[model samples]
Target: MREPVTELAGAGATTAEPLWRAATSARVRDLAWCTLAPPLLSAIPREFAALAEPGGAALASWPPGALAAWQRWLASADPDLLPPTIEELSALPGAVQALAPAARSLRLGRHAERLLHFALEHGEGIELVASNLPVRRHGPHGVQTLGELDFVWRDVARGGTGGAPQGQLVHWEMATKFYLLVEPEANVEAMAPDPCTRLQAFVGPNLVDRLGDKLSHILRRQLPLSRTTEAEALLGARVDRSEIYLLGWLFYRDGVMPAGLDALGLNPAHLRGWWSTLAQWAQRVEARSPGSPGSLDSPGSPGSLDSSGTSGTSGTSGTSGTSASASSVRWHRLPRARWLSPALVPEHETEPFETLHDALAARFAEPHRELAWRREAPVMVCEMEPAGASAPGWWRERSRGFVVPPGWEERARQRAVQPPRC
Candidate 1:
C-alpha cells in the first residue's frame, strides 16, 4: 500500500479545480495531468528490485523538496506561475507545435512524451538537457541504431551554483500504458502461484503488450542504455542516475481486483478502471437502466464509477450515482489522443447507448482494410452526463471502460502468457 506521490485532479473539472485545469486549452490540461499524475507502480517489484540498486540500475530520485515545489507552483495564485497559456505554450518548441488540432493523430505515448518534455523544460527545479537522443553504430553494411534515450536532465534543486543548475545528471525512461487484467481460468483460486507469473496476466487491449515483458525490458535494457559508452559519448556527461516513470491505468474485469495482487508492488493509489466484453457491458447497462431493480443509483451501493471510469467508494467527482439518470446519460468513444484527459464532449456529439452498441458491433464485425491489426481491437468508451448550468450544451465524462469484441478475452489470455515483443 505505497502512498501516491501526488494528489490528482480529475479531468473536465470546471470550478474549484487545480490551477492547471483552469487553462482554456485541452492540450494544456492534458499536459499538466501527464506531468503530475501518480506513477503506475510505486516501486520496482521485488522480483526486479535488485536491478534498481546503485551498482545495478539506478532508480530515479526526486530532488530534495521537489514535490513541495510542484505543490506550491500548482497552488500558486500568481498569474505568472499558473499553467501557461496556449499561445505561450505554442511558442516553446516543435514538439508542442503539434498541440494544434492537426496533431490529433499523434500516438498517446508520443503525446505524453511531448507533455513531459514541456514540464522538464519549464517546471521548477529541473532543466531539460536532451530528449529522444539516438545511439547508433556503424555496422559492416551501414549505420545501425541501437536505441534512443528518452530524456536526460539536471536536478537543479539538488545542486545549483548561483541559480545555474550544476547537479546530478539523470536519465529517465517513461511509458504510458493501459493494461487489462486477463484470467484464463474460471476459478480465481486456481490462478498462477508465482507473483511475477501472475503479473504476466495483465495485457494490452491490442494483445501485443504484456506487463511482465515491459518490466523486464525496462530493467534489463532501457535503464542500462544510458550507461553504454555510445550513450555517454553522445550525452557528454555520465548519467548519475536512471529512473523509470510508468503511468496509466490497469483495468480489471468488472471493476474487481483479484486477491493477492499486492505482491506486485503496484501502487495502491494507481489509477484504475474496468474492462468488459461487449456482452457483459450490455448486461451491466441493462441492469443499471433507470427502471431496473438495484440500479447503479440505488441507495447504499458499495461504489460508483468516477469521471475517469475508475471505481471509487466516494461518489464525489464526475456524475454521482444519485445525480445522473441512466436513461438520459450518453456514451462517447474515446480516441487514442483523448485518452489522457477525462473527456469533455459537446451535447450533440454523444449518442444513446443503443446507437453506441450498434456502432461497436459494426466495428468489431467488419474487418478494417487500412488497420487490419485493429479489426477486433477493444474500444474505450466513456459514460457522459450533462455539464450543468455552468457548461450548458456540453457533457462531461462520468465513467470510462473498455468494451472488447467476443472471444477477445481468450485471445488476450493467450497473449498474456506469451513473451512481450518489445
Candidate 2:
C-alpha cells in the first residue's frame, strides 16, 4: 500500500498537530485514481466479471457513479461476495431478497458498509476481529486520543508451498467522498508532485472540505505509525500492516466535459451532472412543457414501471422518438443525504416535472420551513427519460443538472482566481 507524505514536526507542535500534513494538490488526482480504480475494476457489472470480461460488456451497464457506490461498499465487504447487476437484481435469491428491501433503503455509504460487515461476519475461512475500534492514551497534560480505525481483520494467507498458515493482521481505513471539479486549469488537475498552492481545483459544497484535506488527514494523522502502539494494544495483537480503502464520485459539468479535466487524471467514465436553483429548474420545466404528464393536482398517480423487468425499448435508452419533451421527461429531486451516486429512482416514485414543482411549492408554503442553498445542496434534478413498458425501475439519464442558489458560479470562479495557498 502506498503511503502519504509525512509532515515534519514543527517547533512547538504536538505529535498530533504535526501529523496534520497536507498532500500537494497534484497528489489528489493520483489519490483519486488510487481511491477509485479498485472499486471500478472490482465492480464487474453485478458479479458478471467473467461475463463482462470481453468487449466492454460489463462497462456498458456500469455507470461511473453507480459503480463507484457499489465498489465503495465492497471495500469492507467479504472479498468473495459480488455486486449484482441491475438485471440480476430482478431475481435475487430468497435469502438475499429477505435483506434486499432494507438494504435498498440504506444510503449508499452506510448501505455498503453494512453489507460488507454482514458478508465478512458470515463468510468462512476468516475470523472477524474488530470494527470501529477507538484508542486513547492518558498524558500528564490530559487524555490524548487517536481516531477510529474502520476495521481490523485477519487475513488467512495459505502458504504457497503447503507450509504453515500465515495469518496477517491489517488495520483498514475506509471513507467515501463525492467531489465536483471546480477548476480544471489548476496545477492539481495536472497531478503535479509538488505541494498544491491551494485546494481549489475540486471541492465539496462547503469549499473548505476537499480531496487534499481528506487525504492529508487520513495519511498524515489517521494512519500514522506513531499511533500503532495504542492501536495494537487495544486490539491485543500486533498489526502487520495498515491500508486505506478510499472511494469517491467526481462530478463534472453536466453534458459538457470541461477543458483540462483529462490532464487531471480523472477517469473518463467519472460521473457528470448539472445543478441550478429551484426557480431555475421550474423555469426550465415551464419552458419545455408546463403541467407535464397531465396531472399535478393529484401528484399521487404518475407512471408505473411495467412488471416485465426487461430493459425496454424506450426511456433512458431513448429508442422511442419522444425527443425528450418535458412531459416525456421523468424528473426527481435527489434526497438531501448521500446524493453522490445517481439515486436510482424506482418507476413508482417518479412523477412529472409539475409534481416536483407543486411539491416544492407546498413544502415552502408550510410557513416555518427554511430553504438553505449551498453548492452541494440536494436540489439535484435527475432528468431521466421515460422508459417503455418493458424496462421498469430502470430509468436512464436523458440529462442531469444541479440547481444552485444564485451566484454559485461567481463564488466558485472567485475561489478559482485566488492562488492556491499552502
Candidate 3:
C-alpha cells in the first residue's frame, strides 16, 4: 500500500492522485496498478521466513527508481512518456477489442501474466530477457518438462551501486489469485498450531488451490528452478536473485474479519471483496433495501449503499451521484478473463439484479459441459453503476463478489481441510 506519487513535474498537480485513477482507460489502469501494487502478503509467514533472507529462495532485486519511474509514467499526462502498449490500448475503439489480445485465454493467471509482460516490454529501466522459459530434462521415459520460469530480467540500472553486478540476471515468479476464506468447522484442534497453517483457510473458488500450498510451491520449487544446472545453462547467466509478484483480492465471508489473521502475514492494504451463497446475498440485498428493517450502514453489508439504499459512487472512475436504486444496480457476471480490473462495460452488457438472479438460477439448475458432476459452481458478479455524464451509456463496476450455489460452502470447507494437491 504505497502512497500514490504526485503528478509528474509540469503536470500542474499540487495533490497526489492514485495512478489508476489518472488513467483514462480501465484496462490500462489495471495494468498500471498491477505493475505497481504491493504484494498481497507483507512478508513470508514465520514458517518460511528464513527463505526471505539474502541467499534464500525469495529474495527480491529491484532496479533503483524503477518503481517510481513506473508510477510517474502511469500518472503522467505527457504522451511522450506513455508506454507504446498502453498508448495503443488506450486508442482502441472498444473495450472488448482492446482487452482481447491480453485476455485471449480464459485463465485469469494467464491474463495477469500477459498484462505484466506488456508492461515489462514497454516500460523503462528493465530488460525482459525471457518469459515463460521452459526447463526440460531427459527422463527414462523421454524428455520431461520440469517447469517454466515466469520471467528473467536484467535491471538496467543495477551493478554500479550496492546492488548486484550490472549483467546479473534476476528471476521472478508472478501470480494473480483470488481466494475466499472458509473457516474451519468445530474441530480446530485437529489442525497444527503453526501460523502458516492458517493460510489453508483461504481456498480458491473451485476448492482446488490454497494460499499456503501456493506459497510453499513458490518458495520450495519455483523460486529454486532458476538456480538449477539446466536453467543456468539455458540462461547463460547465473540468476543472482529470485522474486515474486503475487497480487489479487481476498474475499471474506460476508466481510467478517476472521481471527488469527495476523498469523497469515497478509498485507493490510491488500484488495478485498465479499462472498456469500446466492440465498445469503439475496437476503442481504433485500434487508438493505429502502424501508427494510436492516440498516444500510450495518457492518458486513454487501457493498457501499447510501442512506436511500442506492448504489454509491466508485472512487476508481471519479463518478458521482446515486444513479440507480439498490434493486436496480446493474450486475455483470465477470468472465474469468476480465477479473483482474474494475470493469468498464457498455450499458447493454449489464443487467438488473433480478435478471442476473434468474440467469444464475438457470445456470445452477441446468447441467453444463464445464460441470462434470451435478453440483453447481460459483460465479463472480460485479455490481455496476452509471459512469456518470462524463462517460454516458457506459457502466463501471462499483463492487464485486462471488455468488455460490447452495451446499457449496460445506464442500469448500471440506476441501480446505484436505492437503493441497500442489
Estimated TM-score for each candidate: 0.79, 0.55, 0.77
lDDT of 3 by residue, 179-216 (tens): 99887765444555665566787889888888888888
Pairs that collide, model 1:
309-400
Please give the ranking of all candidate structures by TM-score, highest first, separated by commas: 1, 3, 2
Pairs of colliding residues, candidate 3 = none
Q: Is candidate 1 or candidate 3 better by lDDT?
A: 1
What digit string (tens of lDDT, one per residue) describes model 1 on residues 300-356?
211233333333432122223455677767888987767875666676778999999
- Candidate achieving the largest TM-score: 1
Q: Which portions of model 2 miss their true places by more than 4 Å?
A: 1-112, 122-126, 158-164, 184-199, 225-227, 262-265, 276-327, 337-341, 346-348, 354-378, 387-401, 414-422
lDDT of 2 by residue, 92-191 (tens): 5554465644344334454445434454454444456876566777789998876766666665642312342556565556566655556544443454
Which candidate do you rate higher for TM-score, 2 or 3? 3
- Worst lDDT 10-window in candidate 2: 295-304
TM-score preference between candidates 1 and 3, better one = 1
Misplaced by over 4 Å in model 3 are 1-17, 21-24, 50-54, 59-64, 75-106, 138-142, 160-168, 186-192, 291-328, 367-375, 420-422
